[model samples]
Target: MRDHGIAHIVETILDAPENMTAVNEIKERAWQAGFKAGYNECLTHVNPLFKSGFTDERSGFHGIDIEAVYAAAVDAYNNLSISAIEDIEKCLEAEDYVDRLRLLFDRPGEEDEAAGDAKNDAGTSGTKVD
Candidate 1:
């Protein structure tokens, strides 16, 4: 699993005007929730809100204020004292994400097992990996 930087994500989302009101309402609710919980609970919440490489229309998030969700997630991430936000950003950007992630994490992706079989599969079944 990967934890994207919710704070930056929320900020970028709120960057667009149409998302303004919805984000604000969510923030307000988060504040109320904090009061009820006796602490700022928004400081803890991080999970995949959306996949790394998928585009979704705003309407699909009828009740989900992306900014709020991200804000809480980022807070959770920071509080937990962990690091992986940068890699997630690169993954979201769609520009050589895997390579970027490898560089950020100081490792390389798994060897492509299908590479050797691609030509054989294509010749026999007219199917290709890409």
Candidate 2:
């Protein structure tokens, strides 16, 4: 897909009420589980290793523990923007894949049919009657 189209999807999800609610629920759960602070601390420990591994990818990743990576992922979930996290939750709630995608483009801000029809009629003249 084009970049702008992906951006539009992001914008739509950010505006969706259901997406917002799901995101908020995640935040609340993270707070209750003490994952927020754990996530911050995990970032400090793992980010340097992750960056180095990314920079080299051949030799730098030799000793990084798999469990540490998993912990980082779980902790980092709380750091994601609610709208971003909603992408997964919303997809799960969708009836099907295509319908889920179509929801993103159904803009509430679209212009009304009458305004578009008027623009199309701009060059027309009134019809003469017998």
Candidate that scores best on TM-score: 2
- What C-alpha RMSD separates each model from the true structure? 19.6, 15.1
Tens digits of per-residue lDDT for model 1 on 5-122? 2444455444544345445655666665455343223223211343343222223343556556657754653354222444366564764554344344432343433222433343
* Clash totals in order: 1, 0
For model 1, the run of ten residues with the poorest summed lDDT = 38-47
Q: Write model 2 residue lDDT over 26-75, tens digit each, in one string.
A: 55554534543454456667779777422223333335454455455556
Reference-based lDDT, residue 74, model 1: 49
At residue 62, give the lDDT of candidate 2: 38
Error of 2 at 53 (Å): 46
Residue 90, candidate 2: C-alpha displacement in angstroms: 15
Candidate 2, run of 10 with poorest lDDT: 120-129
